[model samples]
Target: MEDSEIDHVMSEIHLGCPPATIGPFLSHFTFSSYPLLDSSNDQSMTISVDKDGDLLLPRRRRRTSPTSHSHGSFTVTIQHSITSTLPDVGLQVWKSELVLSDFVLHNMSLLNGLVCLELGAGTGLLGILLARVAKAVFLTDHGDQILGNCLRNMELNSSLFHPQAIVNVRDLNWMSEWPVEVTHADPKPFCWSLQDFEQVKSASFIFAADVIYSDDLTIALFSMLKRVMSLGCDKVLYLGLEKRYNFSLDDLNVVANGYACFRRYIKEDALCDHSDKKSSFVGKRIDLKQIPQYTKGYERGEDVELWEIRYLIEGCPSNTILIKIQIKRPTNIFVESISKAYQALTDPGFQMGIALPQFLLDIDGASGGILLLWIVGVCILLPLVITVIYLSRSSKYTGNYVMHQTLSAYYYLTKPSLAPSKVMDVFTKAAEYMEIPVRRTDDEPLQKLFISVRCELSLDPKNVKQEQAKFWKQHPAIVKTELLIQAQLTRESAALSPALQGDFRRVLELAPRLLEELLKMAVLPRTAQGHGWLRPAVGVVELSQWLIRVVNCRLFPLVQGSLLESEGISPFLQLAHFSDAVVKKIARKKVKSFQELQEMSLEDRSELLAQVAGLSATAVEDIEKVLEMMPSLTIDITCETEGEEGIQEGDIVTLQAWVTLKRPNGLIGALPHAPYFPFYKEEKLLDSACGCSVEQRVVLSWTKVEP
Candidate 1:
């Protein structure tokens, strides 16, 4: 090569990570394939692996596959790997830092000329990125090595900062108290200044990325967030995270222990708003789709996410007591005393004949305590259906039938014409239009049911824009239909006489072929609307309003939910024990949901079944069997390393799971009544038939290999 070409090539030397191990080294995360900005800054980031100056480090086998990236990127110096200990793991450029950087660029308007501080700012890439717009940026972290590396990276990206940008590198330990006195001796890289402390306390925004991993470290981080976020003036914390999971012996299941630790801080309403009554940290997930991936190169996998959290101004002080709530697991006596049939039954594969959702719907809210069992289909345990208790609700629910009935009720009220018990209307309309036999009855038991989060925030006028930005996740098919309809309308409007552009449906009439063109892209289904049904009509309206910020969209491939009734049929009937005559007698009572029955007291249940509901004593006995099987089990779960109290990423921690079959603590009702959540002492008498006391424990190991 010529001298000029060689000079140009040398100028473009950038960091190169080996495939053997993972590094915070140069990697790309592309949310978009199209160019949203000109002049990519991430180019020419050459860190030579051969030499120190040629800081290009050889890659090692990474724990996961390398992600891709695209448009408007940046580069920085990163350590090949950790040299000191756990905290130094921050030395490398974690992908979370890059992911958060994209959000900063997209929301530059909010950060422009505002005080911003980054929590545990490892490599200073995120803070440096913020330096371009933030009025003042404090890149905070502990350790002289990481602090110094971050400072150097600041100089490396100095060209990217605003002309008057003030960037400070300082020490902030998560374990220490707030306003940590200046611990750095003279001549060290960073020391806390009074002014810097004030700036941090009054900052407009706080950002942290790739900071969560260890169980102990997560607690420390949460404590820091609570303390720092509470002191500041109405500041929002944008956290970027990647879930790392592991297999454990305690539950003998793969679990994200560190992530689980982090989730304990979230309240049920946290996802809805930044101001919640339950916890100080009110957080909601920021949809990645709303944030453009302008800094391209990496594939933003599903596990990676960003959260927008607000520390409620009226929150309790930092000194608020930290209650360690752990619901105790059931004892062997508790489990064995409840289900003697399981021990005595010969067939291990005996069908429970009940779906998990049906069981959940049967009982009213478990407000007292929850009975959690480890339910496994494996015969290794010989029909030991352990009820594992989980205090926290999973963020995502992936069942087909759970919310179907609710969905039907919600969507029925959407169109005034379809208001009362018109769940069957959705199907009849489609069947009438297509002239096909509607193989689905309203009571046919939904095959693939989808129950979205209730329309609490979606229908609210104040949350329109935010709801619009996130609706794609819930109603993809409906949104697609809207997109096609809009496209066709736009095309017809362009071809029509200006006067004819007003009516989209009229334009469709004007061009009969346009209707046929649309049918080509139809997402059709078979019996039961191809078995894809959505409960809650508001969910449909919410989706349409989100895409157009208005309500003119198609509602196709969406069906309503139905109720389950017990007849003489086996599994088809919800209550397999009830005969056809018994079902008719129970039907006269008009029990809308099983929760209605669950909420009744013992006397009410007996009277309603035998007298008011016109049921015989035998039928009442069958009702008791189902209710007796449900023990509001309390699950006390915790995780820690062999000797340590806190668990960090990569540290294998024992996840201890304990389940209780009855209320060992809390209220013991006088009558055989339905014990609320966490307490179920009254139900124990139902298992009098099974007196054998046996404690069984089974363990399995799963070692996942990544290629």
Candidate 2:
């Protein structure tokens, strides 16, 4: 057919008026120019709706010479008419706007390197767009009338169809296989295989727009795509629609079952101010939503509506990429309402517990004691029964039953300490006693304590016997002892007099190290002749260190000092503000003094150290010499008290002191190791006397001390 003839026919089809009026209508719209067409060429053609929503290139003509021998050429024809029983015209108009735009065209463009197939190519609009860009396109329809119309439309708009475009119009019946006369080409580089049509294969991309209006066709279409298309490559399927057209509930069900990852691509039109032409339309946004209903099953009686869909068929070794069309109402308003409600409900001061049912709280409260008892009973009985059975079976296991009994008793007596409230109070009191500053803003110190305790326990010996004993006997005692010692240390440190503060500080410094060493001793096994003091000693040493490092170091600086000179620099000062050169100079001067002290004569060092240690003339000079050359020293002492206010038997009082020798050049070494000079060894004497019973006495004269 000639381009003019096709234009005349299209004008008639579009007008839905008399065929005679088509020529006049075309002339009236200035669309009289026929599109270029060469019938001799063996190239495919295309037609599409332009931006103005009008059919582009209404006519084209081509001629080919007749051959005696028939080459493999096929003819297809299509016919379309507005049915008399149409729905609301306004709805149809809205749908037409959605269907005939660049939405499908742009998506098809994205599949440029793949073969594409369009089924139900009513007017061949989408197929034409695909063929223009995709490697190959197969435009298929059920009836001759539809195919004829598609071919005529393609011929009319040949301009958009590139030379590489290969569009084969075939009759595709969703329920059946390809017709016997159709020869399958050696699967073109790209080919659209209609579902149930065996002639086409190896297509990587599938596209359908507005195909879900019929539910039956939607299912059949997906089933067919699933059978073809290679797995392992992501097959891109783009579906464009304005959803209102679905009539059958089954249609909705088919969509819900077929596609997995469904997304919507919506087009936006922006106004152009510079040109007389209308603003161009482009796909502005893409939204992804799961079509769970399709993959699962839909609720009965729900109406199926059209949705703009983009689907991805993830390639699998066993299955091909299957595309399915589903309809859904746009969820903008529904989503907004949910989001707003969520924000309001989550706002501060909106207590979630208030909305919880009373029954929930009742259930929780009822479960607490029962749950604990159940756990304890299981823990106690299971181990005991197992141990008894094993011991009965073996003659060498006499101690097993005794150990089990001990554990049972421990569980019953010690389990209550694990209660949340008791644990919280334990931590709070421990912090207070150790003089460790506890933050008032913290509500769950016990939770933090529990985490640290768990970490410590994991690093401990994991033998079942040890774990049982430690949990029931040793651990609780350690916790209690540490807490008591901390409280005592904090209280005594807080009450120290100015004259005795320095002496007391040195005693406190040794307490932590002493306690730690004691803990190590307690855990060691001992023979029958000796009873180990390891447990008590460990408790003592840990308590001491806790008081010195955690309590004294943390709290004493915050205390206002009236009698002691503020010349001692605070160790916690931020050194980040100082320049590199300043820090280096301070470090260099300290290093120089250290070198000088290392080279000092024994007598000079002994005399110099005597001034710091308060050693008498009769005391060992070797001890004095060693003390003088020592670069740094730390001392801690702890005392346990009973019946003191807020103190218990395990309560520990601690004092800590640190001394860093001053260099002769006097730089102070940027804090922590600041300059200090001793005229007498009175401080050391005071520390020793404080640790002794009433009989101990020490004194120093300035003349004996060396400067």
* TM values, all candidates: 0.36, 0.25
Off by over 4 Å in 2: 1-80, 84-101, 107-109, 177-200, 230-233, 245-707
Q: Give lDDT tens digits, candidate 2, residues 241-330.
A: 434422337445434322221221122313212222322112222332212111101121222223332222231211221211112433
Cα lDDT tens digits, model 1, 626-663, are 56543343445655454333445676756666554453
Best by lDDT: 1
Model 2, position 106: C-alpha lDDT score: 30
Judged by lDDT against the true structure, how good is candidate 2? 0.37
RMSD of each: 32.1, 34.0
Model 2: what TM-score? 0.25
